[model samples]
Target chain A: MDELTAELTDLYNEHYSQLLRMAVLLVDDRSAAEDIVQDAFVRVFDSRARLRDRDRALAFLRRSVLNKSRSLLRRRQVSRKYQHRLVQREPGPDESAHGVDRTVLAEAIARLPPRQREAIVLRYYADFSEAYTAKIMKVTPGAVKAYCSRGVTRLSSLLRERV
Target chain B: MTELDTAAPRENSDERLLREGLHTLVRDVEPSPTALSRVLAKRRGRSGSRLVLGLTGVAAAATAALLLVLVLVPDRSPRPVPVGIAPDSYVVRLADGTLASAALETGEVLREFGRVDAEVTALAKGDEHVYAAVAGEGVLRVGPDGTTRRVRGVGRRAEVSAMSAANGRLAVAGGNRVTLVSGNSTRRITLDTGLVVRDLALDRSGRLALVVRDRDGGAPTLRLVPAGRAGSDRIRLFEPACAPLRIAWSSTGLLVLRPRDCAARDAVRLTTIDPRTGGRIGGGVGIRFEGPIGGAGDVRVSTDSADRVLVSTATGKTWLVDGGGVELVAEHCVVGRNCTPVPAAM
Candidate 1:
């Protein structure tokens, strides 16, 4: 295999699952998240030469996955508006009481504005620094702080009410 | 797991719950075993298709030339031809931070309107002036005679995020506040605490169409506010799937340029919506680029007197879209090289 392909393969093996998980958190749909992750990988492959190194390629992959998830949400919103339909997922057959709580929390996270949700997921779930999160989101660090603060507060209120 | 989780510090109950919940939420998610192979196969397929497409295009071009001669040379029948009416000129911030008017048909810099600091973030054109929003500085109004002056009232340190102008008025947005300026009469409208303005437009009647996002959470919405009312007295339009990167008011309707999808780069869709009711007017045109055009924030659109739209990107590319179609009019700078006078506005 070529050097670029080999490097990408290594990066994919190491980070695909993590990126996939992050996509799931961002978009909430497992299949869509998988498609987003795969598309991101394909995009990275298409732009591999410009990426130059593994680190940049990985960063590009993360950004691409995030962008794709956001796009999916935007598309879904458009679909919901024009069609006047609601996307309701039925509870799985073996879903436990814990699964219900998880669903509620996920829904709350999903409801947060796009930036706030991104900030929350990047900071708490991905454990990124405020500076790094800002870098990824292309916003100021202060903005990231504000988003995280507002997101956490809203999530707390939402989860409290659900409980 | 990645290095991200390794350096995480201890968290409070809420933070801990959030982190734990996020982890548990995706615990069962994984890519199918064939995901990697599928990607590689798709890549190969795309590469193969490119060659096929290139060959097909050559054959199609030859056939089209033959048909054109056959249909037009001997047959004197009159056929309706689509005429492309290009805008005369439009304003853009050059890579060197200079704002200039460039001819749409010739790609020539018609006139230089002076330069602002490199921190200028947004640009809008009024009836008698051009405006540039400088980061951490107020908006600078450039008159027709090339005089630049900072508009008063908006605080000096206001970090203007978006700006739009129409009729005789200008709308400047910073954080959650929008300031409307018209003939020395400036009115400020503060949005709800967490609502952030993404892009905005002003109709001929002075009505405002704002694309705003709730920082707390929810889809971004298009809202219509009356001319002189507070933001609270606004009507929420439908939340768009592809949030508009830029919006402009045309004679026909509100011109919205958005990514074809959320993950947009190569192409964008320009749609028209009824200013009063947020209903789609018609299937808009799709503007494609050679590659990604920066981010959504970097794309800007402006409508000329004839209602023709000029779309500019931070990557130094510009296109003029009219009833005929979208046409690439200028490349002020290269992508990675000398993109000095990037089109900040127009």
Candidate 2:
């Protein structure tokens, strides 16, 4: 098989499900998130001419997915505002959590500042090495280390305090 | 408290709690697997069919052209107005997005009617005039017979993006502000919006509404404020589970909302909301559609007094649905602005 196809196949096999989950966390909309990941994949597939380095394909996909998530969020904001004007409405009820523990995690993650939440997701949930996380986030490895350190520290302390 | 390095907390501890919560949410939130496979299958089938149809059509057309050449016909000068075709006003959109009109009766006669310096992002028709907004340059007003003038020094260049004309006034929203431009005066309304203004609409009564999104990229807030009045009581209408595909407002108690999943081709869905309550007005509260736009062009949506929606796409096709089921209706090319007359004939 050609290098791009092989690389795409490998990356898809390894990260497809995880990426969908991550998108859900970021957008708070599960269907939108899944769609975002699929779009990221299509974008990567379409970039056959530019992605010559097979090793960097995974990193490219991760970055593209994050960007797509941002765009989706932008559009979601617009839709919500439009809906509010028409209905004179209120924020909908919080989606019920699956389990008690899961609810706690979801609340904590949701409360996190955008950057810190992103750091936590990339470092822990995605299980990327610090170097890989740095590349995906477009930050220095030291910065990635610091984000992970601070994120984990805060997460642990918050959970501990809750207990 | 000396921090104990006991990593595994109780089953109800935060780590386990968070993991469980995330897992459940993920499981509950996945897109339909069938939706994905269905999109792929449809795309492949359509492409294959198109290839075969295209080749056969090309060969048949070529043969027809050859026969026509063999049987030469008399060449007559084209007539100005073709018989039975109604004479209509035409706007030749310039590269800079200006609206210039010409007499359609004069054999497709093209003319530069007006000069709008900026991109004409949106166009709306009024009772006696046509309005075009040049995003920043302000609105251009034109008469039915090609007389044009600018509503000069009314709206700020930096704030205006799109405009909708209602009640003989043009409502524009941009830069955390909304303005009503009339004649030679501007009435400005400042909003405490936490999000950037993306688009705006106006109802028949001139009440204004728009969609704005926060910088953090959450679901956008739709705000409704009194037309030309700022700092009014703004409320949150609905939080779309996905970004909107299209949004339009109608005069008679109808709000059209099309919440589209941005990723897959099957993600385009339509929702119609009650303009006053922001609730799904008809059949069911949770409005959803199964069809996707999938690179469709010339998408046009219109609503009626009964809140029935007609979605027209580029292929000269129309669909009839009661704000939910998009049932196909008719097929025709988008003729131009004058194609549909305002105030449906009784």
Candidate 3:
């Protein structure tokens, strides 16, 4: 194994699961999240020369996953607008009755405006600090706080009746 | 409050529930075991596929050359009647980022203008100079001898979306703002806050035709405004079903290139509209493409003094439209990739 490949393998083994879970929380689609995470790894490998440091590589992977998820959502919105139909995946047989509340909460999170959802995911799911989340989102920390507050308020109201 | 409050308040019940909910939402999610192997496999496959594509591209180029000769040589069809400012050549930014002026019919590069460090977002040509909008770097005016200089007064970091130049005048649209430049006097016109300019055109008489869409996304609308005027003087030209890809002012009227259906982009056509009343002039000519063209910067349309229209896609495919007929004239790829060519003014 070459030096770059060895470095990539180590990064992949350490951070791939966490990034994949983060993407799943952001996009709410398992297959799409997998694709996003895999593509982010491939892109990081392609640009590995610039990201020789482990910390920078991990940061790049997180940013790439977030950006790709945003692009997928934007494309999905455009497709939905033109198709004039909402697409929902049918629940599998293994989903228990307790999964219903989780589904409701997931739907509410998905309904939050894109930035707010991103903020909520980064803050609550990834558990990044406000400054770090703001750095990744390329916004001010105050903006991150605002988005999370607004998102939580909306999500709370949305779940009051169902969850 | 400071930027970072490390000792934040403890989570309330709602916050705890939200956090728990977010965690449980993806509790069953896990990365595929073969994920890293898949990425490596794709990386390896890309390099191998490039070699195969390179060979196929050579064969395709030879076949296309033969077809071009066969189509242009023995045809008995009537020659197109050239109207308006019949320009003989056009300018193209190659994949290597260099600008070159090329012959319209032969696809011959006449002169090589130097490359710009920044990407060229838009291109236009007036009688005396060729104007290129370099992203984040305002616009540059290239003289006849290929000398280039940045035009002053336009914002240094202007993200120019579309540009048109004619009769010693230039109209540049960035965001919802349009800047009209004539001589040394420059006037900036601001449209509604939420409007995003997609494309704009300039007539010989200095009138401006703009295509703009809502920032929130919808079918783009055409608008006509006089030069050096504000949005209040704008007249809304109808909303198009399929988004208008490109618009050009011709001697006959305003020409718009649009896909036949909103959902299907492969079937594109050019329609002539009355500049005054915004009505279609006849059924319009269908532009056949070998493949579906990409969006926005992928397709470009320009017209000459003789009303001859040139359509070029980023794929390096050039089509000539004249007298209600479309002909594929050239297909020249740059660096094994697609290239977009913008026709210059005569």
Candidate 4:
């Protein structure tokens, strides 16, 4: 109806699935990944007025999804580290799924450090420009390059080792 | 500098692999219908998000309430029972076909994707990929994430009649031959029998079962053709009464929809015959359900490759049956009848 609503619809319709995919890869849980994407849309919708160029809304959404994903990952890592009791961890969606090429790749990416995983996921998976990846990741272009190189190398070895 | 200026920055073989793999990884996965509906309803109920954002105090209070609910309350919802479905189960169907994987308990579509150019006739679910056969085109290897790679070297005129996937590979019976497609390599096995191949089924060991019509105007025959060979060691199983009883290899064994009586259109029994030895197994499954399982348009049998045997009628009725008889999974769609069943794993 309104410009904001129209823009939200377009972005959600076009990019929400992709953004959801990005989050799913970052975090292996489907429910949590959807929540992360939902959080991203809420963030974007709340700050829509500040967005001077609506064309860049997708980029903003991507950035927000990455940010939200990173936060969730951080919380997961902390919870894993500080658990007082030896609780059995529940298997996530990706872990439960057997077979399929993407399932293997997702599991491997999940094992990488957050920055390296993000670098590979953005530069290669998302096909983002290095500069744009650097902006979303909040790192220097050189750092992005290093992360991508290391991530790719690690991924190659990780997948190869599995075989 | 040129790399920086260009659209692709540091594109390489590894990047290509990453891109391809990642694209396939998330292709068919969609956000949960529950989460999506929640967001949609919120937007519709409140005209503007601006109104909510402007009221920071209200937002804070709402956030506090949400936090309180999370802390003070414990989730009591019953965990959904496992419905013998693979975690990454997916299917490929025609655009008009209902192609959404749904929650077992709720029957709400969990994930759905794929809008192909050609009509999807056959779908094969492999361990690592889902292969779809489009008529007059070629077989497409689909990743769980929805990325599709049209198989090459199989030729375009292979109008797929039946398909099966197992052990990280797929086999499509198009026309009078069956082609085994894995990665980049394809091997074709022509029947040379002068009979049209009707249906196909493959077991975990790659044993193929075919239903073919006899050129001499005799009863249609079923053939057990092994992989990588054409006619060598091929065994003709028996005559299939129903044309659609071509071949469906379930976890139990190779399943055949055997009609109860030669003339009875509505009643048929499901039997597991050994693909290696054409002998019928111990006990057969016969449903006592009363409905229109007519000879109107031939019965269609689908499986989730785990623990499901869905028999559908031409008039839009579907029955979920086990080894013995019918199980009431859902008569109509959980959402509605207009909702499509996602191929095998509905």
Candidate 5:
């Protein structure tokens, strides 16, 4: 009804999925990421009338998603460690997954530096451009290139060792 | 030199094996519908709130309000010729009989950007050349005279992920590398593992781009390699959580990145940043999500001019957008749609 409410609504409409996608990549949990983005919208709505521009509001949401995602990663990592320790302590049949012809090459990829891993994921997983990627990661295009080049070289070496 | 090249061939063989091995290991790992639906549901709730705003007051007020909100609200958000201005734009349509390209000015049939082909997966346009990726093959190039060239590489197994061309040079994404082919000269930049290249873009300066996935261990990187001999440089673009999948470059060296919803298995968000610095451009670049519009499958970002892009969302919708946001070019676009002529914004 009010200009501020209408604006916040449009901002949510325009950016909800994009924000959630970012949240998913960060959190790795579909349901939680959705909640994170929803919470972001709620934040935007709560500040509706005071917002100066829509672009600013959207940026705020993206930054929020990025922050929330980091926390999610920390949580996922902690749980993963607990699960690993549990498996090691219990010695269950699940341990056989270790022998299941784990693709060494995939493991090498998974072993890349986190920066390189992210670059590879964007370039390969979702398919994006360096400039665009730089935007998402908040870096320069050249830096993005360096990460990929070095990352690929490392991967190549790892793959070679497998052979 | 000679020794490296000799060893390079052996390494190439290994690389090929690795590629095959990687594909085999990960090909089946597509996003699940359940994941996609969950995200889509969230988007609907968010987007629906705004779409519903068309409800109350005067049409003009609501429309203006919507436009402002859409433009300024951020995220997820082209064209042409004449000495410096394009008088007629291209739009493909399945009119009466076959596919046709209708001129915006004359409303007459110009040649179709050609052949129906097997479901074109990607498309790009440069100064005088147009490129499209046929579902199964590499990129197909169409010159100004309508001549076609199907670019080929050493391996037939690599799929063309995305493409960009300008200044007589064309760059294509094959597997994890971005290959630049000019005449017969070919140079390839292979991407790092765990990184999936979603798109390729080239700035006017002949800079090459590889847009990769975003992961959390560290910041996701956007690799900008110069087209010249100096080669690659790694720049941290955004934090790993960004998860950019689709990318485009404007002539001005502005880069457009779109976040993808792996859950919905769709191109969900788009962002524009400085290609060189990776900072948010002062003026906003448009990133429009077209999926919820009409079963829009995959969103493709192609250069409309050096400055703007034409986003064809899976819904058969195309928007002529600038850095600001999605400017409604045409709504309800059908599949196999030809490039439509967009009028200069008033």
Candidate 6:
């Protein structure tokens, strides 16, 4: 009913699913993906005073989601080192719920180094333009192109072998 | 591959497969309905919690009506002689972030305590020297002997954010990992919780405690990582709350400054805990202040007095707290040197 709530509702209704998918593709865990997206929205709401333009809300949310996902992945990696099997229960191999052969795709993307995986997710999975991906990743368009190329090359090799 | 863009190049088969495959993998996914509601509910809860705090500021008028009460001290036997730093020397951070220790009366820098090239971000002192985290660099030790050497095995490129030292043991934390160092044997410890490192503390026996914050805006946690030699038994401790920004250690116990209402952020409770088990040691003092301190300065444990603790803030506020009470011994001044009432135990 209020202005802030009304604006957030509209944004959430429009892009919540999109952002969730983006996080899922990057992090490869449904529960972690949902937390990452919610965390991003919380941050946007908390720092609403700093954003002057209404149009940039989506852009800001996207960038925050990417950065938070990167940090979460790094933290999880470090945690798994010491705690072993207790911290990370490996998901048994299963086919995609949508029948899209996502297990292989997920494994390949996870194998890519963090930055390349991030670039690939923003460019292809989220369907952002090169310039927009650069803005979200805080790199130049050329850098985005480079990461995507390297990531795509590696992913293609891995997926091809699965056939 | 689903949702294949028709505008793709006629060549480059790898790009096509990757993009099309990604679209198919996520095309059917949707956000949970409860997710948006949870977000809205959390913000509402945060807004409703911000109530203007009423503080019982420093008891000034009560000085005339001194209601002296006998203090009941704990019966723990006197432990081994605690290590680190001479009783009279004081350590502090200048306004520009340089670390220095001085005499109690004249504010003369006895010796600078870090490398100049890399700014000192975090500092902790031992008896002979001060162990400082040089921003993006690892740990550096500076002392009365004028010897400066980088602490090995703590990753030379590590941007260490927190350092805690007592006796001969040291623990340095940045991110989720903590490097426990004693002499030449250094061990890297990764906390089981996938949380960011907010603060770190170490007792004289090399017991480590870390304050880790969740990815969300929830209350932070204080987790004591159990450390002992091979085949030695250990006890684990974990306390979750919006912990204060600083944690100190003395011969008696580990000291934690717990704020009353984290949302209001006014009054603070000074508690001493058994380092091995997170158990409270004795009756503590309550301190009410107007605002938060600027940064973590230094913590000097009292060897002579009723085991009082001296803590300094970057904004030049020094406090002395014991079983009796918490007193503002200095304002706009570091401990030992130039502090009002001249901190007697420093």
Chain B superposition TM-score per model: 0.68, 0.51, 0.69, 0.62, 0.57, 0.60
Decreasing lDDT order of the candidates: 3, 1, 6, 4, 2, 5
Stretches off by above 4 angstroms in model 2 are A1-163, B1-118, B153-156, B232-246, B260-267, B283-346
How displaced is residue B300 in candidate 3, in Å? 1.1
Where is model 1 more than 4 Å wrong at Cα?
A: A81-100, B1-10, B49-346
* Candidate 1: residue pairs that collide: A71-B262, A74-B241, A112-B217, A112-B218, A113-B217, A113-B218, B94-B341, B95-B340, B95-B341, B95-B342
Q: What is the C-alpha RMSD of each candidate to the true structure, in Å?
A: 18.3, 21.3, 20.0, 25.1, 22.9, 21.8
lDDT, residue B272, candidate 6: 65
For candidate 6, lDDT tens digit of each residue in B1-346?
A: 1222344654376666677778766666788869889988876776555322112223533543354333444557878343344443456555555456653323345555543455666666665667777766678876644467788888777867677776677788887778888889888877545566766777666676666666555556566665663221222334554455556654456667666566655556666667667656644566666685332232222321124466555445556553233445456555344422111223
**Window of ten residues with lowest summed lDDT in model 2 chain B:** B337-346
Interface root mean square deviation per prediction: 10.8, 17.3, 14.6, 15.6, 16.7, 16.3
Give all candidates' CA lDDT scores. Answer: 0.72, 0.52, 0.73, 0.61, 0.52, 0.62
| Tens digits of lDDT, candidate 6, A26-116 | 7777778899888777667765553334557888888888877877765664344312221143444644433325666766777776667
Q: Pick out the ten consecutive residues of candidate 6 chain B with the lowest summed lDDT.
A: B297-306
DockQ of every model listed? Answer: 0.20, 0.10, 0.21, 0.11, 0.04, 0.17
Q: Which lDDT value does model 6 have at B333? A: 53
Worst 10 residues of 1 chain B by lDDT: B333-342
lDDT of 3 by residue, A24-96 (tens): 7777677788999888877776564645887778778989998888777656643443121111545555433
As for model 1, its CA RMSD to the true structure in angstroms is 18.3
lDDT score of residue A4 within candidate 3: 76
